[model samples]
Target: MKYNEIKNYLNGKFVSGMGEKYDVYAPINGEIIGEFKAATKAQLDEVVAKAKAAQESWAGLTAKSRSKVIYKYRELLMKYREELSVVNCEENGKSMEEAYAGVDKAIELTEFACSIPQLISGKTQDVSKGVNCKEERRPLGVVASITPFNFPVMVPHWTVPNAIALGNAIILKPSELTPISAMKMAELWEEAGLPEGIFNVVNGGKEIVEGICDNKDIVAVSFVGSTPVAEIVHKRGSANSKRVLALGGAKNHIVVMPDANKDAGSRDIISSAFGMSGQRCMAVSVMIGVGSIDEVYGEVVAKAKNMVPGVDLPPVISEAAIKKIEDYLDYAQENGAEIVVDGRKVKTDEGYFIGPSIIDWGNSKKMSSEEIFGPVLEIRSANTIAEAAAIQNESPYGNAAAIFTQNGRFVDEAIREFQAGMLGVNIGVPVPREPFSFGGIKDSKFGYGDITGVSSIDFWTNLIKITTKWNPEHKVDWMS
Candidate 1:
């Protein structure tokens, strides 16, 4: 089941592609499971052409009809959920449970897109005389999605299904690390009667990514990656006047109040800090606590230390990532960051594992003010809740910030004062509902929201408004 041999989809058939090849490995065990063909520029161009050709008919379909295909695709995905989950786990190295959850989330997004037909319905407006007007969502010709590796299935599920349901032909460039699941899902979409090239998967690294972003045939580009990469893609794509939605990294924080229950805060912090091995963009990287709650905050540190890291929870995606985590931890310690918990020392069965890391954080020049994408949490002490909130607002990344408190007044104040894109009350991770938009302020996100909400549909399609006005007596030449 090598990735290259698996199939490169274009024009509806699984074709043996001619391109540079790379082997895909399971991050947990470091075993080569398959190979993937890096798409040649020629191949990408062909994909873009096919997508354009197919989009004409696909975009012409009524939103209701487009929604039906998405519905069928959702049904197919649901039926094969287990199989898809297994593939996701084996390749992405996430725990079996988390892998299954990711698949379900993708399914959930598909269902959300199913409801877009009504959500995207145009609004009518009245003009003077015998006039009626409306504005409707129109597909953006051909759109390209460049997804990340963290939640391989889930990320694409957020973009692809919605884009297709909105009547756009899609050319997807899934992460090279976990490309198999995406390719297989495209197969399932084909089974659901998607037209050839209506949904295409091209595998590659920067070449393919840049090609998709720069191609004029791709009317829009949607990206989910690091802030630097997102910035670059946004710049290049926008220079060409393509609609670009580039979501970047996040540095999330959780603030604990003196009056809050330490037990509850500990539990939430543990889950939010280490879930998916802290590979998520919304993972809590910093913890700020009022001085009065220092003892309670120590409990948070103790809990983070106790979390078991291994093949059971999925290792960081690659050896390179593990190394990066190591370098960051070393740098933090050298810069006076207290090593509360060292994940590098954690024991594991067979896979790449780092237990969890916690640092007594300070506002030193060397201590990171940005997001750390690993099982690491930094604890910062503040003299007052106001001081803690001030520190959080001063950080460069404003993706998500949460507060643990029983006081409605405090929660209200924090919500009103927080500078982050997402805010949480008692909740550690502040990811919004599927119907609500997900993005961040500052460096956390670029352009607009990515998935599962109105903003996402807007990202995939353009809105056009029509206004009509006519007086019966002044009406020009009726075709009788």
Candidate 2:
């Protein structure tokens, strides 16, 4: 693949302007593949102005018309799925299989967008004599979608498809680390018959984020990233009177009961902890074993030990991520934890490679509680299933949690007891698909609505209700 320098996609074209710039690297092999310039505040305002200008005409189209365009875009995405998957893998450093899955998931979100006409059909009711009320979904004008680098295609689709399907013009400020795939998608949107200025991509760092938050023309914001940044975006955007939904970091946990399916449960648990190199927000960080659950733990460790880097596990996103993950391993070891598998020493000569590291998490609550967005697994022991749940509940984040058990009572209890917005029973990664919605409770989510599925319709638009009384003369005082 030929690597090229990327620029801002503004007003239906790839354009560049003066601002802070950052270099983009391919983490798989440790090479500087490209550089992207941040959009200046003026450039940011220009794109927002363009979106504002386009939103009304776009919204004027019937819902079915909007859905048609979205469906076309989905088709275009599917046609180039392999190419996009390659770009995702090249830029984000996930395995080819994982990268393909990410792009496929993005396309799935677009498929969900194709059904927005039905979702926004609205409602009407006859309130009283000669009186009627109708409630309808109205587009929120210009909305900004801010995405993370982890899932190049998937994260943007979390809000973009839903927002655009609701008839809103979008300004996508993707992570500078992975701007190539986003810019490429802009081309596909144009090909799919989306109007000029209706969809735009502006790559930047902090200034562009502030631009998105503070710009009055932007009516809503969708953000996905670390907890600290998610909080900032939510507060700043809300302070500026824009609707905001921000998904943040998480330390997702899974509990293993004594009666759980030991062999199969352990394998799935290992996958949950190590898949995507454990970089996913939904990845299980801590596994709590209830009494006599050693079978599951032992099996999980056994399966994890055999993982081979660059083949079984992909590299982390950056050199800094390598150091960050290793620092955690060092800290854990120094704090009475055992490093069951030392990923700190990489066998691969090239790439930002790090194998899976398993920690016993003996006395380090810090290691178990913190969000280690890497292929690091921490294990702990608890006396009861409730005790294990209590340990998971201690986390400040509530993105997702899972339990492996045969008892219906335990599953039912976990459904009520787990604080996570997404839950799993005998499942590892329990991310909800379309129509089910995805978001978390507590610090995991900053705003009121989920970023995807049926629940997201409210976040991307506003409800407009019309009350009519053409002939309101109720002279009939006779009780019927």
Candidate 3:
């Protein structure tokens, strides 16, 4: 596909923008790959109107019919999995393997959406004599999905497939940094015979987001990004009387207990911290060494040192991200933290690269608690499991936490007390499969309803109860 061919899709057709176009560069080589036109306000309004018009017909279709279309979409996605991965790698700078994983995850969610017929079934009950009440789930007219640059394909799939399966028309505002992959997805949905305006891709930044949030036609909004931006989306969308599910940032921690296997636990920690260059929301940003600071620190640092930059590792999202990671490393050094393995020294003439970095905070609480969103791991020590749990719980972002302990009792306690939406006992990254809700608590998330699985179906639809009482009227003949 050429650069000019990458335009926004609206109402079942490729629409060229008369507005200003933004240049998109391949992060791998710093080459200009394409340009995307920003959708004007008028264009956005027109698409929303078309989507509102199409949503009624889409909802009118039987669940099985919707499932068939979703299945077809799954087929097309699988067929173009490699192509999509290539586009994702070029745009996002993740390794090919990670890109492939993103594509597979997207396909998995689409497959899950195909089973919406069974998932969306409501309930019935008899409330009183000759009266019965039944709950019905109906589609919200229009939904808008605002996804982040990282995991462009997977994050959008988190909401889009499920929303559409429940018969809601979607206006997708993918991260402007990685819009090509989403454009391809829209094209694939069109090829799968999805109705026009059922899925529209608009390319822009905050302006487009404001349009989606403030638009009365959009009944619901789904967003995944930084906590600050997530709060904005949630507040603005809710203020507009729209249902919002805003998944925010995470400061995930991995607690390595004294009884944990040193070698295996260290390897898992390295993988969790450096995978995708630590751009993932569930990535281990903090390692709480419980009662084994020296032992855990040595092993983790050794493993991290052997991680080769730009080969076993990948670059951060862009030049700006690389600078941000560097700034964080500088802060760590200034705060009396030992820079065990500095990734900023990696040699990359073209791409925005940063290898895995480790910082030993020497049991001090002076380290920054912000979500760095890079391959920088901070090591903190806790005297006991309770102290470690407190450190993990006190963070404002309660997205995910993991404990590497063989002791079943500790595992049980951690499961009970850890303040996170997702918990991993031995697993480093415990992201659930398709049929599960993926979200966090506290400042990590805003609004009700998660992105995927049953929560998605619930978010994209409204519930109503119907009560019926039928009485035979033989005495009505008196009126005749």
Better of 1 and 3 by lDDT: 3
Question: Against the correct fold, how does model 3 do in TM-score?
Answer: 0.96
Residue 452 in model 1: shift from native, Å?
3.2
Ranking by TM-score: 2, 3, 1
What residue runs in model 2 are displaced by over 4 Å at the alpha carbon?
A: 362-368, 475-480
What is the overall TM-score of model 2 with all chains considered together? Answer: 0.97
Ranked candidates, highest lDDT first: 2, 3, 1
lDDT of 2 by residue, 157-258 (tens): 888888888999999998888898898889899899998888899888898899999999998999999999999999999999999999999999898889
Worst 10 residues of 1 by lDDT: 471-480
Candidate 1 residue 80 Cα shift, in angstroms, is 0.9
lDDT of 3 by residue, 150-239 (tens): 998888899888888888999999888889988899889999999998999988887889999999989899889999999999999999
**Whole-model lDDT for model 1 versus the true structure?**
0.82
The candidate that achieves the highest TM-score relative to the unseen native structure = 2
As for TM-score, the candidate ahead, 2 or 3, is: 2
For model 1, state the Cα shift of residue 209 in Å: 1.0
What's each prediction's TM-score? 0.95, 0.97, 0.96
